[model samples]
Structures are given as structure tokens and as C-alpha cells.
Target: MSELAVPGIAYGGDYNPEQWPEEVWAEDVRLMREAGVTMVSVNIFAWALLEPREGEYDFSRLDRILALLHENGIAADLATPTAAPPAWFFRAHPDALPVDRDGRGLSYGSRQTFCPSSPAYREAALRITGELAARYADHPAVVMWHIHNEYGCHNAECYCEASAEAFRGWLREKYADDLEALNRAWGTTFWSQWYYDWDEIIPPRATGAVPNPAHQLDWRRFCSDELLSLYKAEREVLRAAAPSVPATTNFMVMYNFDALDYWRWAPELDIVSNDHYLQSTDPESEIDIALSGDLVRSLAGGRPWLLMEHSTGAVNWQPVNRAKTAGELRRNALAHVARGADGIAYFQWRAAKAGAEQWHSAMLPHAGTDSQIWRDVVQLGADLRALAEVRGSTGTAKVAIVWDWNAWWSVELPSQPSGEVRFQDLVRAWYEPLWRAGVAVDFVRPDADLSAYRVVLAPSLYLVDDEGAANLAGFAERGGTLAVGFHSGAVDENCHVRLGGYPGAFREALGVRSDELFPLLPGEPVGLSEGGTASVWSERVRLDGAEAVTSFASGPLTGVPAVTRHTHGTGTTWYVATLPAPSTLADLLDRIRTEAGVTPVRVTPEGVEAVLRRGEDADYLFLINHGDRSAEVEVPAGAADLLAGKPVEGGTVTVRAGDVVVVREPR
Candidate 1:
């Protein structure tokens, strides 16, 4: 944020000139220039090349790559090449192989194959990183140091002695030699899982034992800590050498690895970055992308994050590999900026000649710059550079949505009464409506400050750590409008039901308690909105201190409290007991919007999503046409679309499908 140095929105992605011969390097540079790529990430997976055998070093190729990027006037997003130890090194030190969850030693066939706790792996990684940092720390072209690639896998850590010792140390720090407390916390009494001693706690093995969710979850947490330690080690070395350059490790968005606790690790990085690849095709797609981007932005306290990796076109890994339409890319890119993105970079710059990613799309397909994808990339780069002045643009959201990863992890660990009640689906059903209407929203942890937000929405908030619950109580008591949805406040952090009532600690705030819940099947109509019956998952509610705002129309508990509102100290809490249809949700949001005095960014004619971002000096409103048909939007009197350089004052703004029009409004 300090404006001492650095340009806005540097562009480019992983470049592997080492994979191709020198002849292709010229074409790569030419095409990169054509596409306006101002940055290049180099040496991402070159550990073997850097250190051929033991105690030997080679930088000839890396030197050429750096020189090439600089020669082409592109900044370097340099990598330490520690992601994978080379095949030769692995062959030399077979003990460096990672151990699977089931206790089998893995062969080095894929990347992400090194055990985090392995001393051999650590020492070698440090040597490589130290060398790379020492050499490139002073390079003028280097802008940032990318620590590593995605740092997660289900088969993390190992039963090998190294990992076991590390796990013991982790437990010692957390439990302080109280193994009994650990057993109790894990609910080990059910299957006689109580451990007599800490050593008795073994890593989950596929062949020898039945799965234990608690132990599995704890293992995941420990593995994450181990990887964090690894990243910190590299980060420290890089920092000591080049303290001014930013450093980061790419994060998997909405990832469930490690009890979903990204908030814990986000602060360690200089800037937040994530890979976004969702498999949904709806008007809400942009919203989904925005929510994830908002989550990252919120993690940084409204600072911008980088879109480190996204598919340029269809990825071969998905169940359905659908190429994005011409305008889909631009819309999605702007969506990132709309939420708070400083940069947009794809998974790869060039499609692989032969590999798992061969079929994956790229900015330049196999045909290079002649491809249509390259044309899109060129245009996107131009637009972004032109708009770079707004790199740190901030958006003000009157509404705050509370998302608790602990609750998500704890709820899924238990075999729920039915699989129909999923954590993610419930959240989407509740959040989609507010998002579609172009409401500026923040995704914060339950413990985040709520005094700044006018409206607070908590969806499927099953986990309530004591401090988090207290924060919620304070927020509601201090005059904030709270919305509580289905399966919320049902249990404490330990997954134990609150002794006093069904709604648990939030009962006083919500002013309601229920003895039973009704789960409806798909296609089954459980209630009605304003005009017709609404289908899908619905819950029956009983009111205590709250009054019914709406009721089920035809269920057994018909005309009962489907939705209730309770008055707190200076605010009101609305409890929605079921998953309502989209229209019904929009209606509820409309009410909240009115009560909170939260205005939509704009009032468009039709088929346009209105977005507004406010920076230190300027505020820009975006009119996005997400539909197939052209949309005619009516802007405020003296506004002009910055992207189009056109003014719309006579109440008419036209936009084509997937078109994004940025309107700069005078403050």
C-alpha cells in the first residue's frame, strides 16, 4: 500500500523456457509482447536443474530465462524452484519420498511429492532457495518471489518417524501432555478410541483401520502447520536477502483442506493470491467468483489479492470441459477487479506440448499468438493496463456475511442425520440472492468487527466458538440487523448441543427455539412465496421471543414460524428456518435492504448487474450485461463509462452480452 514503488496490475504467468529449446524462445517473447504481458514467472520447478547432483550448482539456463524476460521488458515473478525435488535427487535420496495417509511410501511420479517434515527435503529445499534468493535478490527485473505452488494434498504427512515426531510435538503444544483431554475433545468414547497416551495416537492408515473423522481432521491441521513451517523458512531466507520484494504462496479458494482455516495462514504472506476454477454456468457464476474474491479481499482487510491461477479456456480435468465464450473471460476478469483484484494471471501462459495440462487452455494455445485465446488475452491486458490507475480500488459494503470454517469442518465431520443438509448448498441458497442484486458484501469470520456493517448475514453457521458467539451477541445488541438461516446456532464449537435450547447460544438473539426440523426432498413443495408454491429443502420453526414474519403454507407445521424476527438491544435478528426459493430470498433481502438503508449500486433498465468501487480519489460504477441479449441501462445524469469513453446522461446505457461498462461518477 505504501506508494514507494511498484507498477499496477503486472501481467503474466508460469513460463518454462527450460522445457523448450532455445529456438522457441524468440517466438515466446514476440507473442508475449503482442499480448501485452508485462511480467513472467520463471524457474517454478527447476530444482533438479539448479542442483544437478549433491553440492553442485547450475544457473546458466536460469540466467538465460531471466535475461530473456528482461530483454522483452517484462518484470519477473521469480520462483525458488522448491516445489519439486528433481528426479535425480529423489533417486539419490529415496528416503525423501512422501508417505501416504495409508502408510505406503509414495514414488516420485508427480509433483507435491516431498514430505514437509523430512530433514533431507528441508535441507535441500533451503539450499536451493538460499542460492536462488542470493542470486536473484538484486536483479532489477524481479518484482516478486513466488515461494511455492499449491501447498495441499489429502495424503499429507506420514507415519514415518519424522512426521510422527512432528505430530507429537504439535499435540504437546496444543494439549500440554493432557492426552485424556485430547481423547475427550475427539469424542473417543464412542468407539473406545480413547488413547492411553499420546504415542498411541497413530496416523490414519487405510489398510489397518476404519476412518476416524476427528483424528483425520487433526492430522490435516498438523500437516498444514508443517507446510506453513516450510513456507515460513523459505520466506525468512527470501526476506533477509530481498526484504523489499513481496512474497506469496498460491492459495486454493474455498479449499476444505485443514479444517478450512485459511485465515490462520493468510497473514504470513505479503499478498493474498488464489486459483479460481468453478464448474457452474449461471448468471450467479460471477457472484460465485466475486464471493471467493471478496473472501480473499476480506482476509487482507479490504486490500487487493491476485488471481494467481484460472483456466484460460476449458480444462481437461473437469467432468465437463466447456470453453468460456468470447466475453466470459472479460466479464470474469472484471468481476475479480470489481471484488478487489490487483492482478489477473492464468494457470499457464502457453499450453503444454505434452503433459496432463496439454489439453488445458492457455493465453496462447499451441498455435501461439495466432489463436483466438491470444487475441482475448491481448485485449484483456490492454484494458487492464489502461485501467491500472484503479489497482487498489475499494468497495464499501453495508452488509457483512459471516463465514465460519470451523463450523463447516465440525458439521461435516459428524455423519449428519441426512446428506441432504450440506453446508455449501445452504450457504449458496442464502447468499446468491443478495449477490445477484449487486449488494456490496463482505465475507468475514464470525469474530470480525460488525459495528461498521449495517446488515449482518450468517448462513448455516453451525460452529460458534465462545468468542465468536460473544461477538455476534455484541453486534446484534449494538443495533445491527442480523439474518440467521437454517441449521445455524444448533451446536457449540465442540459439536455438543447447547443445553438450554435448540438454537444454542444464539437463542437469546434470535428469540426462537425448535424441537424438530423437517427436511424436504427435491421437487417437494414445502411452502409458498408471494405468488406460488416454493419447492425444495424447508424447515419448520417454533417461535418463543420472536414473532413470525412468514410461515409455511402447506406443510404439517403450516402457518407456523418459517421466518421470525426478534428485537435485540438496538437492532433486529431475523431467523429463516428453511431454504427458500430465489425469489423468496430476493424478497427477504429487499426488506433488509430497505431497513438498513443500503442502496443498490445502481438501478439499471434490465439484465445488468450494477457494481461500484470507491478508491481514495474516485468512485466508479460498473454496468455489466451478463445476459445473452443486449441490455439498455439508464445511468445517473452525469456519469460516463470509462471503458467506452462515452457519457450516458439521457437515462440510456446500452451493453452487449458479457459486456462490462465502467462508469466514473463524480463524487
Candidate 2:
């Protein structure tokens, strides 16, 4: 992949000069230079300002803004600003507004209020995008083109008349206009819901009882593709107009925003970028940064990607906006780079004085240059400059986790066996163990090539198709260590139960057969014979050809197999029937990883993260200490501490509490 057109790591944040007075533009640029800023996204939500009236366009303010940025030597990531249509658009076409699941009509004013499938919205969006492209195609300030704001944030799925028609069209193409095939795929015979005509099928909307699971799943897929089509339409227009500049939209790929299937969306994007914010509720929110960055980089196929938006301190949306501590901001930024980001950016350059996100933190906060936030921003800019060589470097992972949006969507549908089958929780539970074990792992598509990985983990994978199952079995057969978690392989692509037994797909490979699942209560954890407790889940399993490594010590099905191991074609498969305690799970995972001959990038003490990114000349090692005490980090002989600008005296660099150090070791 071609990197962003910048000398080093791309810096700066979203610049919304239109929100401020023209007189302030000079001061903003002066401060940007002070912070060593390089690039910024402009006009992200400026549709109303750019297109004031129907078919009327204004580029005067944007032109001046670009000229000022160019004079200051700051690159621009010009946005099309199609995410928010003007109020006049809603007035002209009220049907463009998205409808809630309850069939309630939504009003304008909020961002992303327009439905994705609306023809009027798409046409108007593409027109503005084309105009912007034609104007700034050759502008010296422009380096990249940002297509839209975050997709599917406010209106993930709409239940309007137009959306229903669009959904019908999408389904027709999917089933090749075969009504019987559609019925068989949807399994609509249970409630006499067979569709004789194409028009009879509508989105699964506002039903009294739980709607057909298959219909709901297809609706989710259709909604995602609908927005993707919109993005592609806009991308085509931009491609023809600004053929050189790369185009991308901000993706919210965290556990909180799991609407789009990024595996499908990654191919459409010229640059894989995302907007990530620390969840206020989680005490250990830094892990979210690592997870989100790895996910983005995997979507980029191990190429470096961009951190489109993050907050300097507190974000305005959470229930309680807690500000970052003194050194927390810098640690957060560098962690993203350690995972795979080549660029670091924020939500806004200067804090807004008015509007919805007035209180959101920024590079230039409302306190101006006299505050700690401003000082930290300046220091971070220098830190990035010092470690610029890490850009375009690729990180390697020996372990891969299977994650699919279809499985996530299907596993959480209503009327499940247990309420604790949360998709995000499952991923985090399995991922945190690997994180603490200091090994790098990549999240792969369900049907992706798994031969490169030494270890593969599928946790709570409740839904899978034949090809995906075969891929997993083939990986195990090729001498890879495979770990299967509870509730996996229960259903196929059509959401129909893989009958005969639970975990139907992998039963042959795992050598275990289970007919019933004993879902434990929230607080009623069952005891394991291996001196630990397993919570939330416990399955009754009988060994077919596998060996029972452990059993349930106390539960409904006492003495039942709790964990089993089977050898299938020279490789081993371990099936865990319950969510074990973290320590036990970590110990088990480490044992299996060691058996498979997979080692960490560099083993370090607790709270100190070690990740290696290999470049053309050298391998860069990022050591981040999340603890309070100082940490002595050992590097290879002749390694230099890039941050300290000195060679290691005794192959050791003492990283202070709440600090980051990057070591450069020759390959």
C-alpha cells in the first residue's frame, strides 16, 4: 500500500477554522507550527456551510483556509463533509430522514440524520464531493481526501419505506430472484412467513415477538452494504475528480461501535483509519487502544494505517467525562503507533467555544497555550518527530483470533441460550490473556488463510459456514494449535441449528460431543477440578476420541468433562467448555503457545508492554510502562533508545513510570 504523502509520521488534528473567526486563523497556524504539526483534516462537518442552498456552493472560506495552511506548510486531509446534510435538504426531501426501529420518525439537526438508502441524500452527497474535488484537486495543501464522518454511528439501520424498498432490492440480488431459495435461506416456514412476491419482503422492523433470526441477520448485512455502496459511490466521484489523492471515511471499529463488517469494508478503503475513544467506565481503557489499533492494522493487511480521531483528554459524550492524568495522554498516543498506526491525530485542533462538542478535548484546548494540555501537545509532537522511522514498518503476530461480524451479529440475537453471550466480552476475555502474556496476535477473517499462525483461537464463535469451518480444521491439520471456546459452531450461515449435538461444526475436529449446555448464573460460578473456577458457562461433554484433561468438580453435571484435547492430523485441538478464571486461562494459553513454539516479541515485567515493528534498516521496539514504578527494559546489544537519543550503556533502558521508550535495534 502507498503511504500517506507526508515526510514522516503525520501529525495534527481536525482543523475546523470555519468554527472560529477569520482573524483567529493566523494564530491557529502560528500555534500549529509551534507544536510541529504536519497535517490536519479540514471541513469534516461543513456541508451546511459549503452548500447553503439547493444547488448553490460556496468555497470562499475553504479556499482561504487551504491557502493559509499551505503557507504554513501544513498538509490538509480535505473532507467532503457529506455526513451532515443541511436543514434545507431535509425540508426538500423529508423522506430522506432515517426511521427508528419502532417506526418513529427522526428529525434533522443532528449529524447523520439522513438514511443511507435515500436516493436524494446520495445524489446530493456525491454532488458536493465532486465540487470539492474539482476545486481542490491540485491544491498544494491537499494530500488526502476524507469521504465522510463516522458511518452508522447515529443511524445504523433505518425502517423507512425507502429503506424497505432498498432492502428488498438487496435481497433479490442476493438470492438471484429465486423466491424458494429466499424462503429456504430465511427459513421463513416456521411462522407461515413465506414470501411469494418480492414486494412482500420488508426489513425486520417493529415486530411484537422476536423477528425471524435469519431476517434480522440479513437486515444487518443489507444495512452495512447499503452504507458501503454509498461510500463507494462517493469514492468513484472523488476518484475521477481527484485521481491522485487517497480517500477514506472514519471507521468506529471498537467493541462499542460494531455495525459494519470491516473485513468487507477494508478492501474499499484506500486508507484504513478509525476514530477511537477510551470508554469512561473501563478502568483499564488503554487496552482498547491496543486492540483497536491491531484491528485497524489487520484490516490494512499489516500495513500502517491512520488514527483519524482521538481525544487529548476527556470526551463529551460519556456519562462522566473524566480527564486524562498528567502523562496518560502521551502514553495513549504512542500505544497506537506501537500497534500499527503510522499517523496520530485528534478530534479537533482547537476546542470549540459553542455547539454540541464544545467541551470535547482538543490539541489547542479552550485554555489556550497557558495550560498543561497545550504543553503536552507540544511535547508529543516532538516525540513523534524523534521516532519518525517507525512509519511504514510492519509488525508480526504468530497467533490469530477468528472474528466475524456475522457471528457477532448472530450470537447476540434475541432468544439465545444465555444472556451472557456478549460478543465484545468474549473477545476481550480471550484477548486480554494474550496481551498480558506479551505475545502479539492478529484478528483474522473467519475464512482467511490461517497457515501462517502457530496458534488460532475461536472464542464463543456461535455461527460459522462450511468454508470457514474447513479453514479452521485445515489449519489444525497442518500442525497448528487450535483452541475452541464454548458455544462455538452451533449454527450455519442460514442461522439454522447444526443439529445432532452442540458445537456441531467442530465436533469432528475437537473429538467431543455435547448435547446440552449448563449456563451458570451471573454469580453462581462452578468449581473446576483444576483448582480454579469457571463462570458464566459450563457444558456437559462426553469424550469420543479425545482425552479429558479436566472435569467439573461441582455443578449440575458433576464429573463432566470441562476441558478436552484431541490430536487431529499431527495438530492438537483444545476445547474449553467454560470461561475459566483469567489466571487459569492465561496459564493454559501460555502452555499451549509454548508447546506450539510461539514466543513473545520480548518478555517484560507486568504493566510494561513490548512490541516490535520491523522496518527496512532496523527493528523498532516500543516499551510502554503502564505501572507507577520505573521499569528497566533490556534491549539487544548495540540498540539505541530513539526517544533518549543515546545508545544503551548496558543493554538496559530505565523507563520511568507512565512513560514510553522506543529502542532501535539493527536487523
- Candidate maximizing lDDT: 2
What TM-score would candidate 1 get against the native?
A: 0.93
Off by over 4 Å in 2: none
lDDT of 2 by residue, 171-260 (tens): 989999888998999898898999899999888888889999999999999999999998999899888987778888889977568799
Each prediction's TM-score against the native?
0.93, 0.99
Evaluated against the true structure, the overall lDDT of model 2 is 0.90
- Report lDDT (Cα) of residue 280, candidate 2: 86
Badly placed stretches (over 4 Å) of model 1 are: 1-6, 153-161, 204-214, 254-260, 280-284, 521-524, 528-540, 636-638, 646-652
Worst 10 residues of 1 by lDDT: 1-10
Most accurate candidate by TM-score: 2
- For each predicted model, how many residue pairs clash, with residues at least 3 apart or on different chains? 1, 0
lDDT of 1 by residue, 1-667 (tens): 3221247776777788887889888888898888878876788878878898877999998888888888888888888887777888788778778787557788886687877788888888888899989999998888888897877643356667678878878887888778887877677897778889777777665634445666666676787788888889999999999999989878877423333367777888888887787574443567677678778888777788888888778877767788888788888888787778888888788888886678888887887767778888988888777767677788788888887666776566646544566666667676777777777888888888787899988877876777887788788789888988777787665566667655677878888887776767667777653444554445556677899888888877677777788898898888887767778788887897678788777766456777778977668777778888887776557777677656766766778877988776767
